[model samples]
Target: MLEKIFKLSENKTDVKTEVLAGITTFMTMAYILAVNPSILSAAGMDSGAVFTATALAAFVGTLLMAVLANYPFALAPGMGLNAYFAYTVVIGMGYSWEYALTAVFAEGIIFILLSVTNVREAIFNAIPKNLKSAVSVGIGLFIAFVGLQNAHIVMGGATLVELFSVDGYNKLNGVNATMNDVGITVLLAIIGILITGWLVVKNVKGNILWGILITWAIGIVCQFVGIYVPNAEVGCFSLLPDFSHGLSIPSIAPIFCKLQFKGIFTLDFVVILCAFLFVDLFDTIGTLVGVSSKAGMLDKEGKLPKIKGALLADALATTAGAVLGTSTTTTFVESASGVSEGGRTGLTAVTTAILFGLALFLSPIFLAIPSFATAPALIIVGLYMMTNITNIDFDDLSEAIPCYVCIIAMPFFYSISEGISMGIITYVVLNLLTGKAKEKKLSLLMYILAILFVLKYAFL
Candidate 1:
């Protein structure tokens, strides 16, 4: 039955291999369960509720990916997108979390429409390959930056952001600054990075998960030794969580279907929706390109065979996540770990989905894992994604300029959509100036998007 459904033998795999591969994929990305709540809570959502939503969203999304796309990709509330939801939209743009969620829901609907009509593929094919690679690398840097901030390894400043030295001293001012009190936390983060890096270097199968767990245990020990204190700047790694209840469910009703659309119909909100739409669109494409290439899911023309199904699944997941009270849920690049583990079919995705469903019941234990511990996993994954930079062609100045703009703008501007906008606009402008605009011919849709991106930045 399993063979008939997933065609495991044709993909050169058995049930055991697929199961293990699914476990490996789930283990690699499970940090999302911890990390998502930590991020979304800042948007004034209940941490516990967000945890449930995150898990449930992952379960549903991964299941859809398995059955619909028949691919091993997993979906979760994306790391950078969550930050955008919490920091930029809710805080920076002064929109309520509810309205922000409305924007996400809108974007998901747009994604579905585009995917169904096959317009999404046209838009994707319209993007210059160089810019696509750049978007991937840019997102990698952005995620790593977010992880470092979460772990207190990096601190924001009035003039600019500053990196904290391990000694807890500021080199520029020769002063013991903010990190002075949290020196131990900084040290733990460094130790976590080292452990994760070593494990990765050693080719450990579940190195990321192992790194997070080991670092978390060390933090518990630090708390026991009194080196860390709860809710203190220096003791972030040591804060103790309540575990009185062995098993409990956090109510998602607080945020479920709570989207407020009254103020979200404005032009600025439309631009915001477009931002979410483009980020999810390109990110999914880039992830699909990477994971599919590894799984041999791409065809002669470099197209995914079941791309419509895969994209529709992602679209639905984003919609479901918004309704359930979380950020954009999309395909995770970490699924590559499962592919490396010999996952070649939907069975692996199904296995991951089942684990995510189980995670719903274990929210208490999972929530106990602190932001600092999960921070390492994000940082490690960021480093892994950075490898995409090697594929960009630097020799072509026209391509490199936009790619470089994209790579730098994401972390600097703190927005993936902004980075993409800058990259696309630059790509269009540079190509026209270089006299390749007519020769190569930018797609009509790409031109319209480029214009919209300019207006979005200029007016809004």
Candidate 2:
């Protein structure tokens, strides 16, 4: 049946290799199980509920990708997108988590409409090639910055970045930096990064999963030795699980179907919605092209067969994710791991979906994996994404300036949407000013989007 459905022989992959590849892909990205809840909980959402939502969304999304798209990709609540939902929309904008979810749901529906109309393809092509690469690199930098902050590897203050100091006692002064201003938390994070980085360099499969497990075990030992504290406010060392409940189902009632449509109609909300829409649109396209290229699925013209089906799966996943109480669901670039492991068809996706479903039962134990342990995975993934920068042509100042701004703005401004908006605006304005727009023959939609983005920043 697997061979019949996935055409394993035609794809030159067998069931066993596909299954192993699926597991490899899942292991490479499973840090989402721990990291999503940690980030969303800051926005006042229930941590346990987010954990269940994240897993269930991945299961359903990956299954949809398998059955509908016949691809070896896995879907999850995207890392940077989740941070935006929690930090930018809910916390920074002072909106309720429910309203933030509404934006995502609305964005997803629009994405579905665009995909069905094939308008999304036009927009994807409208983006300058260099800017597309820059978006990926910028998102990578943003994710890495978040990981460093989560691990307390970079001290937070008014400065853009800084190091911890063994200064005062209370929160007013600073976190108590230990052992010559270098604490156990810092050491653990460094060790995790070194271990994971080395594994990746040595071409080890499941390197990220191994890194998280080893770091988590070391943290547990530190807790037993009284070096790692459970709930510290300032520095790292929060290794304890907040709940001891076992085997009970997580309640999604607080978040499920709680989207606020009325709240999504405001000017700021509309801007926010546009941000989600564009980010998801480009992110999905980039990942599809990238992973397919690695799998040799792209044609000589760089076109991916069955791309519409893949994109539809992503659009549906985003809609479903919002209804299930999480962030945007999109194809993970970590699917490259599965492809490198020799997965070539839908069976690999099916295997991953099954694993995601099984994770729901292990939520009790997995939720205990702290942010510090997972930080290394995010940083490593970020570094992996930076490879896309090589695709950008840096000789043209018109392209290079926009790409540079896009890459730097994501981490500095703390929003992927902000980076994308600024990049598009800069791309259009600079090209037009330099008389290159006519030579390049910029798209009508590009000019319109650039104008809209300018208006959004100026007034909205």
Candidate lDDT scores, in order, read 0.83, 0.84
Global lDDT for candidate 1?
A: 0.83
lDDT of 2 at 132: 81
Instruction: Kindly give the number of clashing pairs for every candidate.
Output: 0, 0
The digit string of per-residue lDDT tens for model 1 on 253-287 reads 88899989897657778767877877778789889
Q: Estimate the TM-score for candidate 2.
A: 0.93
Model 2 steric clash pairs: none
Model 2: residues >4 Å from true position, as ranges? Answer: 158-160, 168-182, 231-244
After superposition, candidate 1 runs with Cα above 4 Å error: 165-181, 231-241
Q: Compute each candidate's TM-score over C-alphas.
A: 0.91, 0.93
Q: Write the per-residue lDDT of candidate 2 for residues 1-460, one digit (tens) a residue.
A: 8889999999999999999999999998787888888888889998889988999899989998998879999999997788778877887778898988889888889888888888999988887888888988998898898888777778655575676444422343544445422356667888999999999899887788788888988987887887766544454435555456767768877778878877555678877887788778778998889899989999889999888888888989899999999999999988999999999999999999999898888877677787778889889878977888999999988999999999999889888778888999999999988999989989998888888888888886
